[model samples]
Target: MKQVVENIESKPSTPILGHVSPSDVECMEEIAGENWNEDCAVYAFHSESLFIIPKQRNIKLSLATLKSEIYTISPIRVFDQNIRFAPLGLLRWSSRSRGLHHGTHRMHNKNQRKRLWPIWVLLEH
Candidate 1:
């Protein structure tokens, strides 16, 4: 996980509207111990202006992909300011099908909700 994080951080940032391959998603999923369907291509957005929300507070990193549908991979915690090492929390958004699905573990408590509110805010924005 550390190696993956280091690799991502060391590589040059992709353009704002660049592409992310299925292999990249697969690699991330493997590192994060999550299962992400890599059947379709993924797009990458390198937003220099967008930081984690909940200003001045600790927030997790999130990656949004819109290949087959809109889904987000948000970490439970920030891993040394790099997202690659953070444990994953999957959020699936499907309008035509079922609505939002929050599949995060241990997020049913008030304290967990408080910590995750910033991620929701950032996703909405």
Candidate 2:
């Protein structure tokens, strides 16, 4: 007896609903740049940080104070200034621990692991 093997092709999955358009993205960028009201300016310590909120919430809250109060919202953008790399501190959580690469151990390579030393820099606004 002989067995036959067949190859099958798969179709693309359905597109996500409410796809964002260029215009929508532009509008959101414009809205995000807004300073809001005087009250908000006082509370907004980080001007560079962008707070993302839904259209409905933005429309409902006329005052920036109220909008600022609503902590729950979509993910906000992390400004470059807000990000830092400290070699000796908790800030280096994103970086790998200082030592040989895990693969190097298996390979028995004694050469340097091309260690990265990230210096911490503080800039004044």
Best by lDDT: 1
Candidate 2: pairs in clash: none
Candidate 1 per-residue lDDT, tens place, 1-125, comes to 35443434444443334332333344544443443222221212233122222212332234344323232333233323333222222343221112222323333565545333211212211
The segments of candidate 1 whose C-alpha lies over 4 angstroms from its true place after superposition are 1-17, 32-98, 103-125
Error of 2 at 117 (Å): 28
After best superposition, candidate 2 residue 80: deviation in angstroms?
24
List pairs with backbone clashes in candidate 1: none
The best candidate by TM-score is: 1
Taking all chains together, each candidate's TM-score versus the true structure is 0.20, 0.17
